[model samples]
Target chain A: MTYCLGIINQLGIVMASDSRTNAGVDYISSYRKMFDLSLPGERSIIICNSGSLSVSQGVLTLLNRDIQNKEEQNLHTLENMYDMARYIGNKSREIQDRDRPWLEKDGIDYSCNFLLGGQIKGEVPQLYLIYPQGNFIQATPETPFLQIGETKYGKPILDRTITYNTPLEDVAKCALLSLDSTMKSNISVGPPINLVMYQADSFEINRKLELRIGAPYIAKIRKLWEESVRHAFESMPEIEWEQETNDSEEDIFID
Target chain B: MTYCLGIINQLGIVMASDSRTNAGVDYISSYRKMFDLSLPGERSIIICNSGSLSVSQGVLTLLNRDIQNKEEQNLHTLENMYDMARYIGNKSREIQDRDRPWLEKDGIDYSCNFLLGGQIKGEVPQLYLIYPQGNFIQATPETPFLQIGETKYGKPILDRTITYNTPLEDVAKCALLSLDSTMKSNISVGPPINLVMYQADSFEINRKLELRIGAPYIAKIRKLWEESVRHAFESMPEIEWEQETNDSEEDIFID
Candidate 1:
């Protein structure tokens, strides 16, 4: 299992992902799930992947090959973020189509998903959730985030805190906390977490981070967030049970 | 979909559940998921269920029939809480086994799960998670809670707040908040929540609640908890970015 999230507000986009992947409990390993497929100045494309490792890796290899071969519809050649998303989705479908039959024979999942978030030269920054079947949905102002895998455990915080007008840095902080919440709740979502913040129209990938296991920054935030949540819970109002005796007393008084 | 939780501490056990069940998004309905089967002064048996509505209802009907007929292995006649769990698990498996073939024809799920928490005479209070396959596991001090259906969203709070020594009222409060969180994150789990708090060795269920949709208490707590969580999230420490310029300056100093 994996958890990847992308949040786009007016200021910029924040993309985050966990690094842990496993074929089974015994065969756990870490791999970078976030890729900065940027052209520095022309177009900035960030892709975060989840699901079957083979399928996602296959899609990435195809994408990099397309770039190396200077294909007509590669990420670097795409004129807009929407086309870039379609290109990635198409590559994903191609890989899944090739592998689905054999993977089915062994009961292996051949599907994968990607979160495409970045800015092209002409378009404003955008975020998309690409499905396993090559379709996608864009994030809007009302719902300014897209998540790919193991999404629910980390969603409540995002639902409560993120908005279209949220600051870039605060969005980054929320994204990290969302990932941390997921990692704490699920063993399969352990980290090293990857995070990237893209400034709208910058067309450059400047602020990026990889917090490996036991990193002090990760520890500090995890500890503080846990404490804060505990404090919040302790502050929740008590349940006010209805008094059955009071109802009987009222009946007796009326009589 | 449903979300039922059971948390047992030294003082007592607190059980709570949401009331929403859906055949599809268009066919959603509300049904109570918590059951009080206590034989006051003899035993206190509370059952909360999740998964296929038909399977759960079938199991419940069978349990009631056995009790009504005074069957030799009925709930009231059971020797201990462990036996009660197995009895419920057996009933669940019986329903699934009988309906699995028909359900399979249409790919409808026939599996269900139950959280059975209570105490019988001469035994300490206990909690058991009965699986669809007639097997169950008990909750211990280290992990004092068991949850079923749409569980992950509500788990982090329980993991952080529940302990063997947590007060009964506090546990009940946490349980309600946990259900509220799940309902907020998922549309399939919603209000008309049911809760019960059973005191250890009392062999009675005195405190029970039904918070219907838009119930004032539910609304108040939901609002308060949302505020508390937002406050907690906002209080989280900021991420400290690594200074890339420092690395370059260090290199220049070495030269």
Candidate 2:
């Protein structure tokens, strides 16, 4: 019911998410799924969530509560990006476990997943996908992106465009286009897109935007991408049907 | 796993499928998924299949046996394209039912789906997607394509390009490209690709091609499409990130 992704390139990390959440067709509503947790000059943490809204809310509440109370093992106390991811994963599992029995009685699923990406004061920038089971995997140079929810429709573009050495601005643009493609194919993932870009080692979140359906920039990106894709398709070489011959039945039949 | 599709256009129907089947990573093999049945000039029926290989083989075996014996309710006895689809669906269901319990005992699935398309004498050209439960749905002018098995990766292009008004050759080209895209993203779907085209009212099967991984025409299309896509992506207008502003906290926070 959501589409969120995080990309790690040489310049830094780019995270994006759609804001639509629905309990059912009639209960559709907009709920922001990206959370920004930055400690001014010390650290910057961005978390993009997908799955049950209740469990996501519970995890976020506990995280913010820990931050406010300055808990011993809060986000602020985490030593590195991996530790931060582990903390988030553990909290997510805790919340899901708390509600699983009651929600299961009503046939509701309480599992949620998160994309945790940011930089700690002493560590290089990193990106991780935290699963509902409290396990996580970090992005590698060979595969520099992680996506959660409604991922297939938006995957081809990312698979073709992104790399570990891609520029920061270009990665951000690709992320937006990926979300735009998903929104077109699936109704469950709607607009009011949230995007954040963290320049490697900056420890500050200055480049962020929220785009709604009618926003001028959003309109420009959608129109340009559509036109470009159409142009690409139009220019493809025509199939040379005349030059090929059909094979005998023996060549094609397995049995 | 397989990727097969049928597109109905003004000129006629275009059907395509990949040739890979795998029970697991180590057991990958090639099995032709497209079968042709033509009474030449009287009827031209093409069937593309996906799912349990054993079930598909069983259904095909029964259909062939009925044809050999000139049974009263064989494929040649079908009155129209819809009737043909129903016949195929019924045979598929019969085969699945026969093996369902035994397969379940081994924790295996005995289900298969089919895309049946072609023309019968005195009937309009048609395409149908037949379910494992022995029910089928025909493609309409508004939504003129049906796909089965590993469909998502190839769907965006079909959504963007194909229509009832598209020319027969173009539709065939689009089907190949769709299969190409699926093969690129999913290892489960691979070459050699099988394509068949039927011109409306012809009541005969004349155009079909089998393309392998290194076939000259396949290589040409892949090169041209990749180049065109890269060019299109490069020409897209760059995003103006500096002009956008982050919204207030209330705009982004769910709580």
Candidate 3:
């Protein structure tokens, strides 16, 4: 399993992913879900992917091969993030088509999804959630983040905090906090993690790191998060218990 | 679809459930997911259920029938919470058996789950998560709360804050906040929610209510809950970038 998140904001794009996968309790292994592609000074792209590791790896291998050949249609040749998203989606579908029959017989899915985002020359930072079938949608002002893989556990934090106008640095903080909550709630998504933040128009990702075991900041965030929920709970009014089954249940509105 | 939650804390027990169910998007109706049986000063049982509303309502109807007929082997005869859990589980299995073949023919699972908590004589307040198969597990200090139906979206908050020492009042607030988050993220779970609380050693539910929809307290809590997440994100550290990729090659971390 993986947890990858991408936020497109006015300043830039922030992307983060965890590095853990397991075939079972005993088959745990590490894999970084964030991949970076850049044509420095002109275009920069980052993708955080989730789902079948083999499928995602195949897509990445193809992208890398295309770049190595200096293909006219590789990530570097794409004029903007949208084309890049379509390019990656096409590569993913190609792999799925090749694997579908065997994947079905073997009871496995060659499914992978990605969040692709960054700046490309004339364009400001943009974000996309690219599906396995090759279509993508960019994040809008109403929805600024795209999360893939084990997404539900970490979504509330993103929903409550993210906005198009949110500061880029704060977006990084939100990313880590979101990761912290997800890591606590789920065993499949673990550290070390990959984080990248592209400050708009800089064409260089300013925030990137691999958080491994003994990351001190993680412990502090966990502790503070517990305290915050406790504090929030202490402030709410306690449930009042005056109504009986026989009483008009509408006794609540009268209160 | 429904959302039901139960928390066992040092101060007491807090249980909440939503009432909406649907055969599809159009055939929506409200039915209470919570049913209480309290023999004041002697015994109390509160069940918040989700999944296969038919099965759960059937199980409840049968349980009530046994009590109505003075079947001495029913819940009132159980000496402790553990026995009560087993009783409910066995009854649920009985109900499922009656509904399964027809449901399977149509490829619909006759799955029903329950969060049962309260007290009987000579026991502290207890909480249990009863599976559709008539097996159940009590919530211990390691996992102080149990949620049923569309559970994933609401689990992180409980994972982060609930523990053996959490106070009962605080647990209620946490339960509501969790429900509020779930409601925002999922369409299947809704209000007006039913909340019930039991005090330890009292052998009776202290108070319960249908949360007044559009109530000032709930509106205030939801606002504060959102503010808390934003505040939490604000307090965490920003991401640190480590530029290791060259512009010429695609960055792939795993083979």
Candidate 4:
């Protein structure tokens, strides 16, 4: 299991992924799920994948191979973010189709998903969630975010905090906190989180971070967030027991 | 879909459920999912259920029928909480078995789950999550809560706040907040929410609430929690850009 999410705002895009991969409880390991296949100043292509390791790796390999071999149609040649998303989806579908029969024979799942987010020089920055079926949905200004894999535990924070107008740095912080929330609730999403912050129209990612578990900055943020959450919880107004409230109302009426 | 949870602490148990039930997105209605089957001064039994509405209703009907008919092994006759859990599980299995084939023929899911919590005289307060297959797991001192249906969105708070030592009223407040989080993230789970708080050895439940969506108390809590969460988020320490940190380190080393 993995948790990867991308937030797109007017300022730019923030993408984050947890690195833990497990075949089962006993065979746990870490693998970076985020890939910066950016062509630098020409285009910035950031991808985070979740699901079948073989399928995601196969798609990544095909993508990189295309770029390396200067294929006629490749990530670099895609005209816009939508084309790039379709290209990634096609690659994903190709991989899944090739592996589906063999995986099905052993009762294994071959499905995988990708969070594609970045910009081409002429087009606006965008984010997309590519489904396992090779279809994808773009993040609209109204939604402004896309998530794949273990999504729910981390979603409440994102749903509460993100908006299309939120600043890029704040979006990045929200992405990290969302990942932190997921890692706390689910063991399958442990850290050494990969994060990328791309400024709109910049065509270059200036802030890429690999926050390993127990890294000082992550540790500090985690501690601070925990203390803040506990403080907020403690300060919540106490419940007014309905029975007691009803009893008081009756007393008032009688008086 | 529905959202229901039960928390057992040293002082007592807190159980809550959202009331929305839908045949599909177009056909949504409200139905109470929490029931008090307690026989006061003898035992306190509270049940909250989620999943196939028909199956849950059937199980509830059966349990009530048995008690009304003065059956030998009704809820009132169960000697302890564990036996009561098994009884509910058995009843659930019976209902599912009776309805599974017919529901499966229509490609509908016949599965349902129950959160059984409270005291059966001569035993301590307890909580159990009864699975569709009629097997159940008890909440322990270490992990003091059980949840069913649309669970993950609300789980992080419970993971952070719940313990066997939490006060009964605080536990109830946490339960409401947990439900509030779920309701915010999922349309399938809505309110008015039914909540019950059982005091250990009291053999009666006096703090049951049905908090409607527009109820003043629920609205107050929701407003306060949203404000508090926003404040906490705003106060979170900003992320330190690793690029800047490394640059400063290099400058110091060069100097």
Candidate 5:
């Protein structure tokens, strides 16, 4: 299992992913799920994958193969982020078509989801969630972020904190924090995380932060977030039982 | 399609569940996912469910059948909460055995999970997660809670705040807040929520709360929880970027 999120806020795009995979609980391993396809200062593309390892690795191999083939439809050759997304989505469909029946016969699903986001030399940063069936959806201001794999556990923070107006670096921080929240709660999503921040029109991937399992900031965020919840519950109105708190009159808890 | 959790703390027991059912996204319905059988001043039992609505409802029907037949081993007839849990687990397996292959033939999974917690006349408050295979596990101090269905989104809070020492009412409040977080992030879950609390040695089922949609307190909690998350993010350290906070950055960003 892995988790990857890409946010297109006002400042730019922030992408984060965990580097853990498992065939089963006992066969766990680390595998990078975030890949960058860009010529620095010219164009940038980020792909975060989740689902069947073989399928995603297959897709990645195809993308790299396209890059090596000197093809015009390569991630590097796309004129804009949209075309890049379509190319990836189509590639996913191609792989599915190749693998589906065989996988089905084995009672396996060739399912994968991709979050593609970045800028082509002349275009603005954009994010798209590409589904396994060769279709995709763009991220809107209403949902300025896309997450794939083990997304739900990290979604509350994203739903509440991510927006188009958020700063690029803050978006990065929040993205990591959201993943931190998820990793703390689920054993299936362990770490060594790969994080990248893209400043809107630079067409270059900025700093990448690599987080090991015992990273300090990750621990800090997890502890603080839990404290925040406890504090919130403490601040909520206390249960009043059968009567109001200020003028309680024999309103004892029946227990 | 549902989220339900319960924790047994030193102060008491807390259980809460959401009420949402969906047959694909187009055919969503609201069904109460929590049911309780309690003898006030004697004992209290809360059962929360998630998964194939048919399977859960079938299990509930079987429980009710037990109540009616005077022959089936029901919660009321069980000697302890563990026995009741085993009853639920066994019934789940019974339902799965009857429905699994048929659902598999149609490409649907009939597996369901049940979270059962309560106090019986002579036992301490307890909690169990009953799996579809007719097996179960109890919660311990190291893991004083159990969650079923869409659980990942809400688990960090329990991982951080739940302990054998958490007060019963606080446990209930935390459970609702956890559900609120999941409901905010996942549309598959909605409310009217069911909450139940049991005090140790009280053996009573008096502390139960039902939160209908638009209920005042629930609304307050949801509103406040979102605000709290935003505020928490603001309180955290902002990521410092290596890029200049200069005109070129602004110029590049605007394009």
Candidate 6:
């Protein structure tokens, strides 16, 4: 049950994710919950993740072992993007405080959640989210976006088309039509979706992609957003009910 | 928090709901979570409900005190419509087993859930749902809809326009645009929304509605479904990215 997201508009940051991952429903799998901690021209991070894939692979193997032990606050020695979202919320609360009491004696839930986003070589392109209690938030310009998992069937088209001056390829085609309307009403959000984008100061991630389930550009953005949402629900406006029975006959001629 | 629904189709059954209720958020109000119960030409029931408004007003006051003591199985001595959805799932598990052990010794939550739908005289139009454990299910013809509570931000437009032949005024404008996209991404699902419909062999519900929040036909179906979903996200299709950078430079000239 995962459906990651991240937008931050004005020509940068997109991030999206969804690569199934189930411990039940016959142990489904597909992993890659987006990671790519860029560094082409110095700092770019990505992160996505959702919940308990062993606490998002133990917070990405303790954030790639704090950048292969160059620690002292890693994520390539954070200095911006909110200290790399407080160093991935302190390594997702230090791996859910060392495996949440032995995975809650087998009930197993070791919570997870991330998002992150990037840009550092002298800050700017940001975004965040973090929480599984370690705490974080960020994304602004009046909430440019930041979701974690299975977020409300892809939040009403990012609450009616994102903002902060949208456009970075229309927020990567509204984050692949909000992860294809959350993998079409969720089936544990399957797909090889991934996405990424980052163009702000271009620390360079070179517009990523991934897609999968019949990917011809995800079947032409799901057949042009389901034929433009069934031609915008057949050009709405019909419910007149004969002007609601003439406004209930003018409320029975004003009683 | 609530957001009812129903649907069915071939020109009948629609339901819909959402009339916020809260015990927190400083006790918000407004009730009537759709009810009705037609008898015109005998039997048309409706119900709708969601959760714990005191176990849906104690399972609608014990199914209206077993139809005001004319018991011997009430809801007009149910005989079909799955015996009136197993008599409203056995009076919602007999009012959550008579007030769930003093509402779980104060942690409250005496669960509730229902949908029910109509038609009885020689039964045909139906719906059901019912759960909080007394178990119920019905709606078929490959899922003709049935939701309750803040159901997944109005389930991807009833999983992309319901079926069983969808038409009863386009399933009452897709159940008022799926309860206005679950009251625009849920703030505990609000508004005076109601709706109703039922048509089939006209057991008679004669179209109902409630609307409110600037109700001029719910402000013209929320200004024509937000201007036909912002003109269907501005006529989709744009995402060439220079033919995906010449198909990623023909996959780097075939590796």
Best by DockQ: 3
Query: What are the DockQ scores of the candidates, in order?
Result: 0.32, 0.45, 0.48, 0.31, 0.27, 0.14
lDDT of 6 by residue, B1-255 (tens): 988888886677888798899888888888878777556678888887888887777777778766767789888877888877887888888778878899899988888888888888886888889899978988888878889888888888778767788668777887888788778777778888878677889886777777777778767766777777656766677665432342332221110
Kindly list the per-residue Cα lDDT of model 5 for residues A1-255, writing each as its tens digit. Answer: 789998887678889999888877999998888887766678877788999888888888898888778787887777877888888888888888888999999998689999998888767678999998878999888879888888877887787777789777668878888788778777788798878898878876766777888877777776676777778777777653432122211211111
TM-score of 3: 0.93
Interface RMSD of each: 9.0, 3.2, 5.3, 9.8, 8.6, 11.7
lDDT tens readout by residue for model 2, A182-210: 88878999989989889998988888888
Candidate 5 clashing pairs? Answer: A10-A164, B10-B164, B42-B203, B43-B203
Report chain A TM-scores, every model.
Answer: 0.94, 0.95, 0.93, 0.94, 0.90, 0.36
Query: Per-residue alpha-carbon lDDT of model 4 for B153-236, expressed as tens digits?
Result: 999888877778888878888899899999999999999898888889898887878888788877877787777766777776
Q: Give candidate 1's error at residue B251 in angstroms.
A: 21
Comparing 2 and 5 by lDDT, which wins? 2
For each candidate, give its TM-score against the true structure. 0.93, 0.94, 0.93, 0.93, 0.87, 0.39
Candidate lDDT (C-alpha), each: 0.85, 0.84, 0.80, 0.85, 0.79, 0.78
**Candidate 2 off by > 4 Å:** A242-255, B240-255
- TM-score between predicted and true chain B, model 4: 0.93
Report the number of clashing residue pairs per model: 0, 0, 2, 0, 4, 1
lDDT of 3 by residue, A1-255 (tens): 889999887888889899889887899998778887766777777877888887888898898889878899998888877888889999999888888889889998678898888888888788899887788887987888888988988888888888888998888878887887788788999999778878887987655777887787677767777777767667666656555555423321110
What CAPRI-style quality would you assign to candidate 5?
acceptable
Q: For residues B114-143, what per-residue lDDT tens digits would candidate 2 score against the true structure?
A: 998988888888899998888999999999
TM-score of chain A of 5: 0.90
Candidate 1, position A221, lDDT: 81
* Rank by DockQ (best first): 3, 2, 1, 4, 5, 6
Q: Second chain TM-score per prediction?
A: 0.94, 0.95, 0.93, 0.93, 0.88, 0.36
Instruction: Give a tens-digit lDDT track for model 1, residues A113-145.
Output: 999988887788889989999999999998999
Docking class of 1: acceptable
TM-score of 6: 0.39
- Point out the higher-scoring one by TM-score: 2 or 5: 2
